[model samples]
Target: MSAAGSSTESARRVAVITGASSGIGAAAAYALAQAGWDVVLGARRLERLQEVAEATGGRAIALDVTDQASVDNFASQIERADLLVNNAGGAKGLERFLDTDMEHWEWMYNTNVLGTVRMTKALLPKLRASGDGLIINIGSKAGLDPYENGSGYNAAKFGLKALTRVLRIEEIADGHPVRVTEIDPGRVATDFSLVRFDGDQKRADAVYADKLNLSAADIAEAIRWVASLPPHMNIDTMNIMPRDQA
Candidate 1:
């Protein structure tokens, strides 16, 4: 693989993207690769991960966000990282609070909150060492404005936003070169709803049946813009949605 940050030469930048099997994460991986950053793709599916890695000429590692061992192993395999895209989170069950199962809530908490934390902790040192590191946490607009029957998903994303903010301040205080950004997207047309609905394709289709929506490429472009900025500048946070979404 190209040396980390070779695109800039002054500093080699390497990006690690999680949940890169498909959708936004996969698009982001391609965008970074196109921009000349060596990329590392992480996800649970080896076959899909291999596809992305081969396409981008990057590396792929099997990663299960909710499992500590898997997360650790993924981190250990990385040599240097300039960007960590914590994009491996999603909503599990969309039932009302009273009807929500504990398993669903647990899944959300583990994957969204704990998973981000696990990946951040494992890669922080490399980020700090890079001298101009960035962390982009993928979140949802629902995290800011809740929707009915979205308690579990909302809670996890809300926590993710909070975590990103806190890390931003703490890293600056510690004189670290790391920056944290949280991207909250609204109604993206991806497999997100399908996964949320537990493989119910028809229900998933209904989410954006009559509405304009952002594509995974849209978010990936935004991410690339933020990462390509000068080392001294950071985008901090952004919220993107289709014009018709609101």
Candidate 2:
């Protein structure tokens, strides 16, 4: 290919996804890549990231949101990101406030709240330079409703909601073209339960056995639709759940 052709192709809109090793983040990477965006995936798992990148014709970067150096290095790998999906988060343990392991709460907070903050800060500049930037933060139903044994996870997601809101408000007030969206999904069957239960497959399977749960693809489609909208239109928050969940 000619140098000009290569440059033109490289100039396409870039989309950076955190936690792109699996589940919702991976799904988003594939969806955006198929739609012609230059997808750059970030995750701690290099092999998994490479696999996703290969499948989607994207690039992979090693990222650990809880660590500043890792995040800075990851940010350096992406030049112009018009879309940033902060999906690198998970529930640690389903425990009531009193019964909770404090360490679990820390993990949840660091991954969900702090992680989003770190990634957003690192990518904000590139996003702003794009002339039209968008951030999609994946939240949860727990953010809206506190339930038994959901204190830690709920707290983290609630914090994310606040971050999403404040960021949108600040950007709008500052007269920036960056759009922020928070997608709160309920009961999507993923490895969420397994991780929450510390790699217990049975526990994970039971969570979705009889329920009509949303797939990673379902969430990915919503993300794709939101990203496809004109720059002037912004979807603030979308609460998605299975009919049964409602």
Candidate 3:
């Protein structure tokens, strides 16, 4: 933890980000910190997470969003949070529906959908208390478009999209100032393909070998922009894609 992480600087809004070990989550933490927001990073990889925390002058806490106990413990450590970026999600396999693997489906649903639910439910109170809270969910283009051999990931992201929408409606209906936004990125070049292919470097390389892909920083910029908006303004959903991606 850095001095900023320990400071009683109540004026600097705190943003809690999950999956902050790398990629969009880590980038968002840096972007927000640079913009004067205190960041609290959470991820399963404590070492990598701490590196990001150190760079951002934020605190790092071990967190596995797919685990209920982990989410609870993470929530307990956060003293304040004006923004929550639910970014811990990814694809597992690329098998077709007929050859569906339940394990892949389970992992996808647990991490992408239920993980957000667990984190949101645990920290909703703190968010409500903030008076100007915002929840930004990192969804994917897979959720909005159906493609071959993407059953598990597509379904998981689609479920996340539904959750984002319903949560937004409920918050509004309940008269809470908490804002919800979903950022669906088309194709961001990250370790996402490597993990999905289970560390097959060749397979991962092919994902962006001959195509224009968005960088993690691109999505991170979007997250920062949404959080920087006025409390009264709610950007329900933002679909960010590379120019060549239709």
Candidate 2 residue pairs that clash: none
What is the lDDT, from 0 to 100, of the residue 10 in candidate 1?
54
The sequence of per-residue lDDT tens digits that candidate 1 reaches over residues 1-246 is 222345456555789999999999999999998988888999998899999999998899999999999989999999899999999988887799999889998999899999999999999999999888889999889889989999999998899989989999999998998988899899899999999889999999999999998999999998898888777787877889999877
Best by lDDT: 3
Number of backbone collisions per candidate, in order? 4, 0, 0
Q: Model 3 over residues 1-246: C-alpha lDDT tens digits?
A: 221233456577899999999999999999999878889999999999999999999999999999999999999988888899999999998998999999999999999999999999999999999898999999999999989999899999999999999999999999998999999999899999999999999999999998999999999999988987878789989999999996
Q: What range of 10 consecutive residues in model 3 has the weakest lDDT sum?
A: 1-10
| Per-model TM-score versus the true fold | 0.96, 0.96, 0.96
lDDT of 2 by residue, 1-246 (tens): 210112358567788999999999999998888777888999999999999999999999899999999999999877688999999999987777889899999999999999999999999988898888999999999999988989999999999999999999999999999999999999898888998999999888998998899999899989988888888789999999999886
Q: After superposing candidate 1 on the true structure, give the runs of residues whose Cα lies further than 4 Å from its correct spot.
A: 1-5, 8-11
Worst-scoring 10-residue span by lDDT in model 2: 1-10
> What's the C-alpha lDDT at position 172 in model 2?
95
Each model's C-alpha lDDT?
A: 0.90, 0.90, 0.92
Residue 192 lDDT, candidate 3, scale 0-100: 98
Displacement of residue 201 (Cα, Å) in model 3 is: 0.9
